[model samples]
Target: MSNQDQELLIELQGQIDQLLESHELQDLTSWPTEGELDTLIAVEQGQAFHITLQRDPLPSIPLTVLQSSSVLQIKHMIRLQLEKMEKNKGRHRRISWKYIWRSYCLMFDHTKLSDDNAVVSQLGIKQDSVLRFSRLAHAKGHHRKAWRHR
Candidate 1:
């Protein structure tokens, strides 16, 4: 990667980290404690596995994340993968991640992974599982309502 690309990645990572920290703080009731996450990660140290994120028109993105990782964390990983993919394609434009998150839901086997705090294993997401993005009801300029993902 070029020096410029490396710098862009670092900047984007920092922004995403800040966004996640603030998001966790906003949802304090569902957010896991650092110690708890550390313990879980330690227990699942050797259980990291790969999963694919598919969005048509773009090549499938393969990511390796811990089974104990939260859905939000998986989204963070996805954002990073997207950045890398763009860099590989020589496109340096910034992505509107906040907009994308608000407009799309990640689905596995047609089931929406709606709980940001839910762990991958809890959502039945295992090795080689494929997740796709689906537009939310309020993806466009419409009144958003509480829609349950069953």
Candidate 2:
């Protein structure tokens, strides 16, 4: 990446970090302590490979890293997850996710999720977890709700 791009990435990362601090739901035990970051440990087949953050964009983070990071916020995770799914599905569109849970699917006020600092472990989600995506909701935070339950 160019110097300008790198600087932009750093700034963006910092911004996101601040957002996580303010908006993420926290799981005290797993949350990032001090300077701890969301890091990636790569694997090859069934064997360990290397640890990496790959200098990738915030929206394109590796899932393994994301899953383990206690500091990474859910709102960001939702965006990355939706992006991952879109790539896997061979779609070239940016989108939001929504879930169907509790009695044939119910719409919810997800504005509260942004304020949660709960870590991924506390959130009970993982890479490749099957869920639905939606562009249905125009409200904040409900843009992409990872539907953990069916």
Candidate 3:
């Protein structure tokens, strides 16, 4: 790295170390998640630094620090990731649905209406409608296909 980059990294590391030392144990749990920290960095302008401390669900504590030498670069990275995630959300949701459908199908044979009826009843779906839809879903090879088109 160039001298400027090295200096920036050192400065950021020191800030992070100081934040970890100064924060109280109980306060670290409330700190934001890693994803949120990334968003904060992306939105900030100019040189930006954040030190978050939180305590919850554990006693040791949690601390996050992010420092960006160039606000524009940080923002660009965040924007790119956000856009990618937005594009993938639908695909992820479809994958989750397919997983649930396959698990249910495995537990109760889709070929038998009686087995499917049992699942529909348990899940509070209308028996007649659910059975027809479940059969169609299986016949159309819905679960057999990958969730993501590409």
lDDT of 2 by residue, 1-150 (tens): 899999999999898667566633232223454422323212223222121222223332333334433422433554565565778889978343332211121111221222234454444444433222222434575554555866
Q: On residues 77-148, what C-alpha lDDT tens digit does candidate 1 reach at each position?
A: 889878867887899988889879998989999999888999988889887899999887743667767778
Stretches off by above 4 angstroms in model 3 are 24-32, 35-150
Q: Per-candidate TM vs. native?
A: 0.62, 0.25, 0.20
Could you tell me the lDDT of residue 64 within candidate 2?
A: 37
Local distance difference test values of all predictions, in order: 0.80, 0.40, 0.38
CA deviation > 4 Å runs, candidate 2? 1-38, 42-72, 94-114, 119-150
RMSD of each: 14.8, 16.6, 17.7
Clashes of each: 0, 10, 9
TM-score, predicted candidate 1 vs. hidden true structure: 0.62
> For residue 9, what is the lDDT in candidate 2?
99
TM-score of model 3 (CA atoms): 0.20
